[model samples]
Target: MTSTFHVRGGRPLKGEITVRGAKNLVSKAMVAALLGEEPSLLRSVPDIRDVAIVTELLKVHGVKVDRDVATGLIRMDPSNVERAHAAEIDAHAGSSRIPILFCGPLLHRLGEAIIPDLGGCRIGDRPINYHLDVLREFGAHVDKRELGIHITAPNGLKGTKIHLEYPSVGATEQVLLTAVRAEGVTELTNAAVEPEIEDLIAVLQKMGALITLQTDRTITIEGVERLGGYEHVAIPDRIEAASWACAALVTKGDVFVQGAQQKPMSTFLNVFRRIGGGLDITDDGIRFFHPGEPLRSIAMETDVHPGFMTDWQQPLVVALTQAEGISIVHETVYENRLGFTSALNDMGARIQVYRECLGGSSCRFGWRNFNHSAVISGPKALHGADITVPDLRGGFSYLIAALGAEGISSIHGIDLIDRGYESFREKLTALGAEYWED
Candidate 1:
């Protein structure tokens, strides 16, 4: 079933929108439940496609997942895990990065695991080599087969010191999950320090795992014989919050984003304020707008945690198009993320993509046609046009662009947006957006 959104443009969105759990964290937390010996309860779990994917994957692994539609609560019991059905597993193998996380938990509990290829944002060649290397360090033998990844723990899995070449989020999580149950202590250096990673660690620690976060980028986990269940409330969706903040900027509207944490979004809020955007932050939420000032252009570069997030770049670029001067964006994360700018160009945005890294910075997408840098010359009038959303965040940027355009826009593949955004249509309607199903 395909769903499309038809949006009539030229509306200034005004309202308070609350964001649910982080999509990036919920799926990983679901996989983390496999480490438990009993049932685990997760609160603030959003009813998005990715969560559904993780739920179906967990159920196929012989675990029962009970979701409360009213409260957004998820209860997972992995005590009776069986070998996940091959056909069902293979069908969603390439669906998201969360599946690869099963390699550690499955191998630990069942002595073997077969994980299908992973799928997520098409920003670069996201290889699981780091994951495989970390698992091998933990005494697991990994083999690549025609169907999927075959991982076996013949020696029953022993912990070892594992150092990541890069602070890849998936790789760091894989090491933590696999090493926690091994025979000896595991020391992981160069770990990804994203807030979601910290949240995952909290969950693991609550399950009776002994973990220590030392300064100078080192994490030590002492192997435990068994792990108990945990109840955790997932972190608020910062990506969703930033997306709505950009929506407020592009439409020149006032939006109060509840459930947005200020600490995790300091970098984004700093950048937003630097570009003549106004924000009022409280302990619980943030309000974004521009009060009595023309929007300015600012240079931004994406980095890991505590830096400008690459996912926030797309929607902000749409807002930057209306700024008076040239705004430069350097994406250092996924290489192919800049492709969506071409779709914005079709809607009369003056954006030029560059293959070579600009602003004296290096990036993962610098060499490929990924176009690591984008220069937006704006204050140009944008007319509504038909566009396709290729990924989750990019889909919302299209919606923001459509809202700021004149006339109407027909956006296809809106189901992709629902993978992350919860109650998206209802939220837009409350914000005074004119949209309908077709």
Candidate 2:
């Protein structure tokens, strides 16, 4: 069902909202439970849509999933891991591309795996070619079917060396999930070394897997015969934390985000400080606010790790709309991530998208026909306008814009925001946001 919200603006949002586990890491950690012979326990789990989707997928495969509400713990027992019907998987997955990661662990457990058509946010073209190519190199057979694709390991999976064309996070995760139990040694070049990837590697290590990493984007894994269950507390969601930080800057309010760490968000914190956002870091969390001064403009670029992430640029773009001068942002990760600027333009913000690299750096999309860069001219007052949510991060950006606008904005497709944000409506209410559901 499509959900809509009406947001009354020109008010600051202030209060404390606690964030939970990282969505990118937690769901994959749940999927990693399939490689275990015993029960696995994950703590600080969030009640997000991706986790719900992963839980449903695991249950249909004969894995028992139990959640404890009080302690926020989820125990996944994959002792009876078996094959699931394609129709059931397709029905439960519902636009999530996580089913593809199941091929490796399922092949190791049941000798075959069936995957339905994969879908996700349409911000850009994210093909599964890198994932499939790695699996094929590891001795898996792929057959194309009408509803989906069928993958099987006839002679068992054998680890091999692979060099990724791009540092795709999903493809790197597929390798880690499959290579843990494959025969012999597996070497991966150009692997993603994001914080989520490190968290997954830690969980795998706790389950008795031997994995090694080098500074030069190389990961080596020694396959074992079996793996046991793991007990871990997943890292806090960095993307969500940065989103709230941007929200605080955009609305010119104070918000203390509990469980937000400074280490993972160092790059974002630097940008936030440069843009004249108020920040107070404590042992437990971070407090973000406005300094009652004019917001400054800065030119920035988004890159892989140790750089401003692509997911962080959207809400920050809304904050940038209030900055003094023209702020330029070059999105090097996803080609079409700057598409949300059109809606901002409609809301009276002066945003111009360009096909060239506007941030003075050359990237893969610079030579392509995609509009990968944006110039936001600010100090422009935004009036409320009706807008439909596009993707997850973009949807949250619209919400930020709506709350900071001068009039009431009718925002449709807020359900997309639940895929990443945990208890956002409740948090919004706690933060004194004026909004209603429809």
Tens digit per residue, CA lDDT, model 2, 81-118 = 98888999999999999999998889999999999998
TM-score of 2: 0.99
Regions of candidate 1 where Cα sits further than 4 Å from its true position:
92-94, 364-369
The C-alpha lDDT values of all candidates are 0.86, 0.92
- Write out the backbone clash pairs for model 2: none
**lDDT (Cα, 0-100) at 248 in candidate 2:** 84
Q: How large is the C-alpha RMSD of every model relative to the true structure?
A: 1.5, 0.9
Q: Report how far off residue 171 is in candidate 1 (Å).
A: 0.7
Error of 2 at 393 (Å): 0.2
Give residue 194's lDDT in candidate 1 (0 to 100). Answer: 87
Per-residue lDDT over 294-357 for candidate 1, one digit per residue giving the tens place of the 0 to 100 score = 8888888888887788788888899899888888888887777888888888988999988888
Q: Whose lDDT is greatest here?
A: 2
Count residue pairs with overlapping backbones in model 2.
0
Lowest lDDT 10-mer window, candidate 1? Answer: 85-94
Best by TM-score: 2
Against the hidden reference, what TM-scores do the models get? 0.96, 0.99
